[model samples]
Target: MPSEPNTYPGYRFPAEVIHHATWLYHLFRLSLRDIELILAERGVVVSHESIRRWCLRFGTDFAAKLRKRRPKPDDTWHMDEVYLKINGELFYLWRAVDQHGVVLDILVQERRNAAAAKRFFKCRLAGLKYEPRRIVTDGLRSYGVAQREVLPGVQHRTSRYLNNRAENSHRLTRRRERQMQRFKSPEQAQRFLSAHAMIYGHFRPRQHLITADQYRRSRNKAFRTWWQETCVPMLA
Candidate 1:
């Protein structure tokens, strides 16, 4: 078999460095500067600027690979929007998650109108490559319109509690945003959150719902599958 092509263009960091950078950014919840400091303590010197670029560039790539290695959720979807700060301005982040609490898609938009809702629906649905049997959302007219226009026949339900799954899904994102202080722009927020969602989806196990031993074993199996199907092939 042919060797997998490298992702870096014209410049390459060691594979170990790439792995460490990806792991620390997600696992330790460290910012780029913190990651730089942590690596420096281990005898690796890298600029924070480079670390930031790596997180933005390679982080997304790694997350994509991780997503491909995971099983797609066939359960119903819950969609919702939450207010977020970007450049001191309030923007909206449209998020969708499956019943299993797996993040399906996230889109950051300036408005919460029908047009914005349609865009979010298109982007999220396209990424998942599946039309869900049911979609639950809050009492938003725009959501109704978007559902009619895009999903058409898909079962659409509007209820306060029906959207709790999606509302709770946003909490992890809010926590990450707080850790970063705040995003400087909408583009930055979109890029970082999109990658963060996939990383969280990969490492997180249902600890509250499952035993610690089960969680550990599940996480290890997930990691091994991810490394084999994503890393060994894509980064070989």
Candidate 2:
């Protein structure tokens, strides 16, 4: 028999199986039952409940590892806040992405006021080693208010049209939100989206900007990084 991964030593399933289910759930947006069906087709019988548990335990840790290994984000940040309908109540999801569309951080909050924006800015900034050179956001007024205090001296550009990089970042998020049938609460939204953004973005290079050959090479490297972070004894 093949060896099980050291990284997942205590689990009944091997790291490969657990990681596969995780990738399917996060990277492919497949539900737990869908992953179960796929695995069963290949003669591995595991319940969706087990897969769900596996994801909850291991997926976020893997993403955090991946996030640490990523190069520092570019200096220009594009930030935005989107309305989330959680539990039939309105909430705000604040997000920041670098010019390359690499997600910086995400925050779920009860409002989009200046205080809420400051909280988001501070939280996002706390994770980074460096501050942004500039930030572009919609003309929310709150962002401007936050910038004066939390991000003083950084070049702030407020325009509805100039923030397409940040706005376009929400497309996948919107899709995932729909698939999950909307988040149940602010905590749930914050916890799941933070992991989901990192995992999904790690695999998805900007394919449109690169040649097909280049895209393949970039993808191969990303998968290698994924394995190095999640698998023990490494994958050749």
RMSD of 1: 3.8
Q: Which candidate is the best by TM-score?
A: 2
Model 1 per-residue lDDT tens digits across residues 1-236: 96554444544666557666876787666778888988899888889888777777677888888777778786689999999988778999999888877788899999999999999999977866678899999998999999999999899999999789899988888788889898889998888888888886788865787988899898887777656533444333
Model 1, stretches more than 4 Å misplaced? 1-9, 127-129, 229-236
Model 2, 13-79: lDDT tens per residue? 8778888888888888788889999999988899999998988888789989998988888899999
Assess candidate 2 and give its TM-score to the true structure.
Answer: 0.94
Q: Show the colliding residue pairs in model 2.
A: none
How does each model score on TM-score?
A: 0.87, 0.94
